[model samples]
Each structure stands twice: as C-alpha cells, then as structure tokens.
Target: MMDCQRCGQRNVLEIDHVLPDGTEVKFFFCHTCEEKWWDRDGVQIDLTEVLDIVRRHRE
Candidate 1:
C-alpha cells in the first residue's frame, strides 16, 4: 500500500491522467493531503515532470 507523502496516510487512490501533449500516465493521489505523484521504479515523481515527458512525446 502506498502512503501519502504529505499526510503519511495509507489511503491512496490511483488515477489515470493525460498530459497536455497527450501522454498517458498513472499516478497516485493521497486522500489525506490531496498529494499527487507518479510511482516510477519505486520513486515518486511530481506532475510537472510527467508533463515534460508528455510534451516530448511524438505521435
């Protein structure tokens, strides 16, 4: 189970977000603090990083 980064709550929600450039990314949302981030290779990445990757996508 994933815990919220801000509130350290174990009640996390999974969401599918499409970036401005049309890249599909899966991230987790912390219901406690409303913290959102992507879990990649055991690391939490902010939404801005995901947007950057999406902007670089072709086709």
Candidate 2:
C-alpha cells in the first residue's frame, strides 16, 4: 500500500485512466486528505484542475 504524501496516511488509492491512444495514466488519490496526483514517467503531476475539466466536459 502506498502512503499518502499529503496526509501521511496509509490509505492512498491508485486510479487508472485509459487514454485514447490505448495508453494508461496512473493516478493516486489520498482517502484521508483527498489529494489527487498522477504519475507521468515516474513524475508526479497535480490532477485537480485536469480532473475538473474532464468532469465538466463529459456527457
């Protein structure tokens, strides 16, 4: 189990999103602090804004 970096909690959950190119992006959500981040080639990216846009444009 991965620990949440924001809250130091051990309840970090992994979320996978498949892209149009058949690639997958892995994100982590912290259940304790509600922190959201994505993994891009081993680098962590803040996904709060991106996620908001996606949800807003979805059907």
Candidate 3:
C-alpha cells in the first residue's frame, strides 16, 4: 500500500506500464490529494521528465 506524500493517504492508485521503447514505469495517483506522479526504475520523475520519455519513445 503506497501512501500519499502530501496527504499521507493510503488511497493511492498505481498503474504499471511499459512505454513503446520498453521502458517500465509506474504511475501513481492519490485519491485524497489528487496528486499524480510517475516512477521509473523506482525513482520518482517529474512531469517534464515524463514528457521527455514520451518524446524519446515516439522518435
């Protein structure tokens, strides 16, 4: 059970996915605070980093 960092809520939804380039990622969404974040290889990544991943995969 993952807890929300902002609100300390345990109602965090997680989605594990693989990008087109075979990069694995985990997307986390907090129901309490409505916070969303992404993790790659167990490291938290920012939105800009996520966009970069998408662009790299598309290219």
Candidate 4:
C-alpha cells in the first residue's frame, strides 16, 4: 500500500503533482490532507485550476 510522503498516512485517496505541465512524478494524499495543504499550500499555485493532476500522477 502507498502512503503520504508528507504525513506518512496510508489513507491516500489522490495523487499529487510535484511539477508543472502535468508531470508523472507525484505523491499520494488523503482527502483531509488535500483540503488542508494541497488547497492552501503554495505548492499548488493555481487555486481555481483543476487538472488530471490528481489521477495523472497516480502510481
């Protein structure tokens, strides 16, 4: 099973991109973490933008 790279949680429900242009590199994250960090963290950059950024990065 995969776990979150940040919190090390095993409830990962989505994949996260570490780079722009929809790269393949990513990490797993749970719904809670996605709302807290992914939505607010400066890492995401665009707030309104939503891409296959989640599914495309899945391992």
Strongest candidate by TM-score? 3
Q: Which parts of model 2 have CA positions greater than 4 angstroms off?
A: 48-59
Residue lDDT tens for model 4, 1-59: 55555677767665455545444343335654653324324244343343455445553
Residue-pair clashes per candidate:
0, 0, 0, 0
Candidate 4 lDDT score relative to the true structure = 0.47
Report lDDT (Cα) of residue 41, candidate 3. Answer: 94
1-59: candidate 2 lDDT, tens digit per residue: 77787889988999777644444577898988998788755666557645654666574
- Candidate closest to the true structure, highest lDDT: 3
Candidate 4 residue spans exceeding 4 A from truth: 14-27, 35-59
Any idea how many clashes model 1 has? 0
Identify the superior model by lDDT, candidate 3 or candidate 4.
Answer: 3
In angstroms, the error of model 1 at 23 is: 9.3
* Alpha carbon lDDT of each predicted model: 0.74, 0.72, 0.89, 0.47
Could you give candidate 1's per-residue lDDT for residues 2-53 as a string of tens digits? 7687898898998766766665667898888887788555666776787667
- What is candidate 1's TM-score against the reference? 0.66
TM-score of each: 0.66, 0.62, 0.89, 0.30
